[model samples]
Target: MPKLVRDRTLPALCPFCRAEILRPGEVEGGEWYDFAAGSCTCGAIFAHDPTARNGGAVFLQALLMVSGGDMDRAMELAEGVDYDVGYVQKYNVELHRLEPNSFGTLYFVRLRALGGD
Candidate 1:
């Protein structure tokens, strides 16, 4: 049996489980904003395409075509992008400049919009 996992902080609902959460939380600053992501408490899992949103696509495109694997510079450049959802960002362990390292692959995730929560 799959363990029940629940996380209401996700930008969207979990497809597998009908977990209900009030909503995600939001934080804001000058030219920057983020959401308080919820931890998955149940075993529910879902797959998402980072480039599904136009903002995500633009950022990913920049990271791949423009930055050419330059995650850091791409991140810096992506700051200006505004997503209807929330925003796009590169996330992962090991924060370093764009250099050859064991960091594997950089991850791009979409945050919830300010009022989405």
Candidate 2:
């Protein structure tokens, strides 16, 4: 089984109240905030993953998952959100890790569009 490398507790703000919403008054990253989970004072479930190493990648995965593996839908969502992931030069983005005997994972993607135009 894959072990949990680490866990942290940050802050989660409330959308309606415009204040930090905590499971309790005082908390940290994973304790108060979870990348995979989020709740606001308004009781809204937010999918903001502050712990994510790459926000863009996380957003892409989220879009794909929510679209039920529909690439077109995911692309549409990405375009609608204005998170332009530059044209795919070449590379296969796999959501899974390679086998032990497989080569290393190296996916080349151009994120320059993130800057603009």
Candidate maximizing TM-score: 2
Which lDDT values do the candidates have, in the order given? 0.30, 0.34
* Off by more than 4 A, model 2: 1-11, 14-52, 78-117
Q: How accurate is candidate 1 locally (lDDT)?
A: 0.30
lDDT by residue (37-56, candidate 1, tens digit) is 22123331111222234444
Per-model TM-score, in order, reads 0.21, 0.28
| Model 1 misplacement above 4 A | 1-13, 27-33, 43-117
| Clashing pairs in model 1, backbone N/Cα/C closer than 3 A | 4-42, 4-43, 5-42, 5-43, 6-41, 6-42, 85-113
Q: List, residue by residue over 37-115, the lDDT tens digit for candidate 2.
A: 2234333322332332445654554344344446686566544353322211111113122223322222112222333
Ten residues in sequence with the least summed lDDT for candidate 2: 86-95
For candidate 1, the per-residue lDDT at 97 reads 19
Error of 1 at 116 (Å): 29
Candidate 1 residue-wise lDDT at 70: 49
